[model samples]
Target: MPDQDLTVAVTGPTGDLGIALVDALERSRAVKKIVGMARRPFDPASEGWKKTEYRQGDVLDKASVKDALKGADVVIHLAFSVLGAGDKTREINVEGSRNVFDQAVRSRARRICYASSVAAYGYRSENPKWLTEEVPALGTDQHFYSQQKAEVEQVLAKTLERKKATQAYVFRPCIVSGPRATMLIEEIPYVQLSERMPDAVRSLLGLMPILKPVIPDPGTPFQLVHEDDVASAFVSGVRGVGEPGAYNLAGAGTLTMSDIADAIGWYSIPVPDLAVNATAEVISRVPAAPEKLTWVEAVRNPVLMKTARAKKELRWKPKYSGRQTLRALIDAWKREGPEH
Candidate 1:
């Protein structure tokens, strides 16, 4: 049984999801203390957190993984390489994640949570319109992100099934966005280059919408979950709200390309599906491509997830819709600037 006043361990507390989860846990009565490990130097006190302690460590190191997870009742794995390119990034995401999962099980954590992505389902045209928990994670061969996410989930599932003492709480969320999270918003070429001006010039141009350049809308739909909602769901897991298994997390609905463009004040012209598909394929193969390009593959065939399991089992409810989530991301970007 899990402890009523738990000692929670978190990997990647510096990330957007990490920050949100840590903030949520700080307010959670179930968590007495939160031990957070990340490569970046961070001060939990700066964030106004009381029960959280920040430690400098990389998930790639086994000793760090063991030390961070020591005496943890619930271990949450969030560290991952997103924008990094080449074989090194792949090694960090896949191998480092395996190390964390292995150590968590060995540490005898009562509840282990892994933040998988909808990308694990892959970008397949033949996939179901609405993927449920039952769908097999058939990862794509085009890029390593989806393939690696799928691979990690499969390995974790197998390991945890054998290690019955520990229960697996795998939450697969799609395109997390919120007031504090805007990596995708800042990096996506279409959104980033909408004005085609320097940061100074773009700010000046913002007042004149007619002078702004137009972006081509691919007509692809996507789901966006607020960063806070993601945090709340993980807190539910830490409290052992329901059965330990995979649960899909997303906003209540989907947002079209036009919706995203409107949120950021971009004038968009819809592109045919055929043209967009060809472009996404070419972009995926670009050497040293941005993480945005790899995600573009999913734009070709948007993966819409069904959050029924999360709602019914995890007792989770998302406060922001996909559209509202995107707006929050845009608002955050406008306030903080794109350099972040």
Candidate 2:
């Protein structure tokens, strides 16, 4: 059995949520040491993250993952490819996750905590308003990110079943937002343009009288969770509080496309679901467009997650609301360039 103080190993520790997780683990008394594995070394000067003993390696390479997991009591797998080519994402997200799990099990790590996503629940018109952990992860085939997350969860499932001694905790969080999510902001062109523009231009745009009418409607349900909140859940999982099953992690309130429009003093136009999906498909075909654009359509489904399991079981509560998290991210982007 693992000792009281845990030596944790994290894969992809340079990403947004990964940074948050490292911060959370650093503050926890249960964590004795942290080993971070990433393709490139994180800046040694970063506050709070300097403590992590980062292993310069890739998760796709099984030997490197095994080496990282050598003395780890728990493995926090956060490595995922979101904004890449379809095949590349599959290789990294799916195959890479498989390598991590296999190595963790081989290394005799007692537990594995995975960072799954709400997209794994699949974007369908028939989705329920509040999804729990029991909902099937039938992710849409059209979105490679969603599909890859679901596939990786299956790999985790098989690992938990085959490795009876090893426990697995999966957190399926919705739209994680924070200052560290720089790449995530790039997915929305308007936000990106607004953030990148000069302060005078931004002030001029803010003062434009008729701008509210032109704000594109976000005609889909949005559930935002702060990256720190997700990190807290992983911290709890590593501490052995939660059971070996999937938990839904989300913030307090919900927001719709119209809600966003109203918040920004814009007239909301509820676009038809089919039209949005079709438009997204067309936009994804453009050779120059970022693949993350397809996520716009993939997330159009009306699925709001119920985070009671995380609260009740893991004793995890999000400090920020969805709106609060969103506003903070936007404000941060505006103040600091999109280099999060």
Candidate 3:
């Protein structure tokens, strides 16, 4: 059975997904208290998180994380360092995770939920494909982000072998989307089309004939889950009946780059073989291509998650379908009237 009156400590509570988790836990009757930890002081006025206490803690600092984990029944480690500082990613993802695990052990926290990523699976070129929890890490050296994630998973697996009392759940979430999303076409740097494209772009592009590219093996198809659903899945994984392990939390249905572009009423452009083959070459010479291609591929080739375990074991159900979720994002973009 789950602990109903548990006090939960959520690391990275001020981030996009972290904020959403804080909000979900705050509204739950089962939760007694929520301890939100972050590097900067959380603004109550802007965050609107009530009945919660904020603590300033750095995951990189073991003492700081240990101090924050005091008296916490469950600790959800959501803090992640992606950009800036060369080794910050490994430091936060690996060393910081060790700190959290150490604190959980000291605090006698019953459960620990770690927010992992699909990047842990690394880059793959499989087909008719869906990545399951069983799929081993790709062991690719392409990016530091994926490498760190895979290493952290190995750390947790080894930790689990040593500790039996404390349960750990790792959630591998796909590209998360929602109303307040800062990614996608809107935030793409130098893509002035996001602003100058006009609201009529959706309708105007519909009339003009556009050619869609067809690739033989376009990788595993995936869709973005709403931030709310991702939060709910974490909460469910912590409270719901299940053994501690990894699970893929993704949106309903498999979608491809062409599918998403078509749904959003946009056209897909084929990257020439030269561009595809020499992506790194071009990225090295031309700075803009890296960011541009990153934005484009993020929407284009998302990895779909098999939600059977999440459904059967956790009884998790995504409230928003991928289509509806995308539509909401488009509507929100329309309301916001493009980037300033």
Q: Is 1 or 3 the stronger prediction by TM-score?
A: 1
What residue runs in model 2 are displaced by over 4 Å at the alpha carbon? 1-3, 189-215, 258-270, 338-340
Q: What TM-score does candidate 3 get on C-alpha atoms?
A: 0.82
TM-score of 1: 0.90
- 2 or 3, greater by lDDT: 2
Q: Assess every candidate by TM-score.
A: 0.90, 0.86, 0.82
By lDDT, the best candidate is 1
Task: Report, for every candidate in turn, its global Cα lDDT versus the true structure.
Answer: 0.81, 0.75, 0.67
For candidate 2, the 10 contiguous residues with the lowest summed lDDT are 189-198
Please give me the total number of clashing residue pairs in predicted model 1. 0
Which candidate ranks first by TM-score, i.e. highest?
1
What lDDT, from 0 to 1, does candidate 3 have? 0.67
Give the range of the ten consecutive residues with the poorest summed lDDT in model 3.
209-218
Screening candidate 1 with a backbone cut-off below 3 angstroms (N, C-alpha, C), the clashing residue pairs are none
Q: Residue 336's C-alpha lDDT in candidate 2?
A: 84
**Per-residue lDDT for 1-340 in model 1, tens only?**
4358999999988887998889999999889999999998888899999999878898889998999999999999999986563366877888888888899899999888899999888888788999998998878877677888888898788778778888988889998888777766766655654544234433333324545455556777788999999999999899898898888899987887778767767676676776565555554464544465666676668799999999998778889988788888888888877552
Please give, for residues 165-274, the per-residue lDDT of candidate 3 as tens digits.
Answer: 78888898877667765364354322333223223432333323324322211333556778889888788755745767787888787655555455555555344433
Give the candidates in order of lDDT, highest first.
Answer: 1, 2, 3
Instruction: For candidate 2, give the lDDT.
Output: 0.75
